[model samples]
Target: MPLRDLLLGLFVIAIWALNIIVIKVGVEELPPLLITTIRFMLVAALLVPFYPVARAQLPFLLLLSVTFGSLHFALLFIGLEHAEAGTGALLVQMGTPFATLLAVVFFKERLGPKRIVGLLLSFAGIAVIAGGPTLPSPLPLTILLLSALGWAISQLLIKRGPPIAPLALAGWVALFAVPQVALGSWLFESGQWQAIKQASWVGWGAIIYTAVMSSIVAYGIWYTLLRRHPINRVIPMTLLTPVFAVGLGALLMGDSLGIHKLIGGGLVVSGIALIVIKFRRAPRLA
Candidate 1:
């Protein structure tokens, strides 16, 4: 990657990292699901005008909307309601291993020694977090893990689809996701009307940041880098997200870091690095 691309990559990672903390702040006032709904509504309104017509791909797009956009965010924001932003960021790393396993089972992709080791190391970190004395609620963690699986499933679904414009896909997915999230919020959550009425400028700012910076700008930069370079070279930059999130959480949210989190987070990032780097270096199958 060029220096410029590397810098852009870092910028996206920072946005995504700070996004976790922003969500923590936003959900503190508005309901998480309502925040998600409004965020997607704003993005969808902005990009739906530019969304390419993909009538043939609408079904897959809807599935992507549900799995990736709605269910994923629904579980994630709900989990973030209770879990620390730093810990939630670490747990979301499970998406990589989940995607790997899905590939192994569904696409018959081989899991070489490094991937197998990576898988174990990743889960080992989870075990550490789970066994720690100061562990957060298991239910929230479980929901977050399921959110990761939903994200992995969305990746697999996207892999099966015809190539589509990144922003268009994001837009259409957001268009479809708005209703799912809105309906979910209406059914399961309360105080939506009250939240909107009482929401402060800071809370709304968080939503706007997530909608604009995190969703549109970050994804645009990410796909641009993928277009310019091999994915392996670009993918590793994401490892910085959790690191930034942990630091930002402590600095901004006063989140504590215990021994278990430090050790476990290290192992998780290291394991993900092993998987991504080793796979990038390995010979392509067939």
Candidate 2:
């Protein structure tokens, strides 16, 4: 990759990392489901004008919306409500291995030895993180794991199915998601209306940052890179996102650095490195 593309990818990673902080902040003022609903609403509004979707594609787009937008965010926010930001960041990295497994099972994609090794390293890292003394709650860990699975499923669906422009797909997904999240918030949160009314400027700013910078701008850049580069090269950049999140959580949220985190992070980074190295040497599968 060119230095420019690498920097752009890093920028995307940074935006996504900052998003965890934003979510933590936003949830302090608003209920998780409501915050998610508003974020997707903003995303939908921003993209709808520029990327109009055909009615024929509505069903597929709706599935994407439900899977990626509603289900993923719903579980993530609920998990974050109970889990520490740094641990939540680390746990979500499991999505990569889960996506790889899904590809092998559903799409008949073969995993090389390095990929298998990477998967094991990642799982070991997750086990270490989970077994650590600092885990907030067992329920939160379970929710985070399920959130990771949802993300993996969404990625596999995107990979195996119709080729939609990334922004367009995102827009349609957000559009479909607005209703589900809105309904969920209404059904689950009795105080949601009061919370929305009382939320401060800082809280609203966090929502805007998540919807615009994190979702729209960051994903737009990522999709651009993915369109131009090979998936192997582009996807590996995601490994840096949790690192950034962990650093930001420590700096901003007063999250502690611990032995388990250090060891698990090292293993996770090494696993992703192994996968990238293996992909660089192997021929592309037809």
Candidate 3:
């Protein structure tokens, strides 16, 4: 990769890492589902004018929207609401392994030895993180794991589906997610409207940052890298996100630097490194 592209990738990682802090901040003032809904609404409204869609894509688009936009964010934000930001960031890394497992089982993709080892390492790390005796609450761990699975499924769907511009796909998903989130807020958080109306400027800033930097700019740059470079090179950069998140969480949220985080984060990073190293050494077929 060129220095410029590498820098862009690093920038994306920074935005995503800080996004965990943004979520932590946003959820303090606004309900998770409501904040998520507002963010997606803004993203959808911004992208709709640039990327017009046809009626034929509605079904798949709706599915993508619900899975990626509504379900993913709803579960994630709620999980973050309960879990420590650092721990939540670490647990969400499971999505990569979960997506790999789905690809192997459903799509007949081969999980080579390194990939298998990576999956096991990641799972073991998650288990250690979740089962750590000092964890404040078990429910947050459970919710975050489910959130990771939801995101993994969404990734698999995106990989299997017809090719679409990343922004267009994101826009359609956001547009479809609005109703679901609104309904969820209504059913579960009836009084949230008043809360949202009284949200502070910090909360609004967090939402805007998530929608514009994390969603639009990060994803846009990521898709650009995907198109320009091999997946092996681009995907490994994502491992840095949680690292940044953990650091930022400690600095910003005063989250403790526990032994479990150090050990688990090490395993996760090492596992991903092993896979990338091995994959790079493998011979290519004609």
Error of 3 at 140 (Å): 2.0
lDDT of 3 by residue, 1-286 (tens): 9999999999999999999999989998999999988998999998978998778878889998877877678889988987778788888877778778888889999988888888888877876765564354878777777788889899899878877788998888888899999889888875686887898999999999999999999999999998999888898888898999999999999888888887887787777666555443568899
RMSD of each: 2.8, 3.0, 2.5
Model 3 has a clash total of 1
Tens-digit lDDT track of model 2 for 6-73? 99999999999988888888888888989998988898898988998777888888888777887688
Question: Per-prediction count of colliding residue pairs?
Answer: 0, 0, 1
Model 1 residue 54 lDDT score = 65
Q: Which candidate ranks first by TM-score, i.e. highest?
A: 1
Candidate 2 regions with alpha-carbon error over 4 angstroms = 276-278, 282-286
Please give, for residues 200-238, the per-residue lDDT of candidate 1 as tens digits: 998999999999999999999899899899887999989
Using lDDT as the yardstick, the better of models 1 and 2 is 1
lDDT of 1: 0.89
Better of 1 and 3 by lDDT: 1
